[model samples]
Target: MTREIENAAGIPVVQIATIVPIMLTVGANRIVPGVAIPHPTGSPELGKAGDKATRRELLLRAFKAMETEITYQTVFE
Candidate 1:
């Protein structure tokens, strides 16, 4: 993982609450709040019609956000 990100410039690695606090304390740039433990994409219970639609929208938005070139903080909330 470290080898792959050697040329990533200023990438910020984050985990759940444990690593999240540490990352934030160190002033890292990005933190992606994962959806779940075993399944990050989603689950069937929360993937009902409406939920799936919302998830799809969120994914699309995340993808679109990758196009932006800003250097500030942003949250999906």
Candidate 2:
């Protein structure tokens, strides 16, 4: 879906995925490695404040990835 959206709509997208290799195999151009499979943005081990911070960091990374220009698939590790 992400690939289709980017190619068909001519829009940039950053995919936040736990399994980075799979997303890369599927040709996801921009990827931010997620925290975990079940909790991609927020960690269950952390409290509310920590979770918020984690999510915020992920969002910031995504924004950074979106602003970057790449000729091929790129991972914002």
Candidate 3:
């Protein structure tokens, strides 16, 4: 059987999640999540180049999930 959320029907969509560094290391740096490479979200050092790039692009896409039309699984290898 498929999984189900409590209010899944009512909830449209929002946010994306990934395996973090593992994904990046596995050629999945393109996926978005609550955090990013080297440093996940909530890190105090969001001023570096890599950190900033991950934060801007990675983070932005995660937020974009909130406006997505439907709830679908987007898995990565």
lDDT of each: 0.46, 0.92, 0.44
Residue pairs in clash, model 2: none
Best by lDDT: 2
The number of residue pairs in model 2 that clash at the backbone is: 0
- Tell me how far candidate 3 lies from the true structure as C-alpha RMSD in angstroms: 7.4
TM-score, cand. 3:
0.39
Residue-level lDDT of model 3, residues 1-77, one tens digit each, is: 01223144544233234454554454332335654334455344655775667556655665564444433443322
- The alpha-carbon deviation from the true structure for residue 68 of candidate 1, after best TM-score superposition, in angstroms, is 1.7
Q: Which residue pairs in candidate 1 collide? A: none
Full-model lDDT, candidate 1? 0.46
Query: Which segments of candidate 3 are over 4 A away from where they belong?
Result: 1-38, 41-47, 75-77
What's the TM-score of every candidate structure? 0.44, 0.95, 0.39
Q: Candidate 3, residue 67: CA error in Å?
A: 1.2
Weakest 10 consecutive residues, lDDT, candidate 2? 40-49
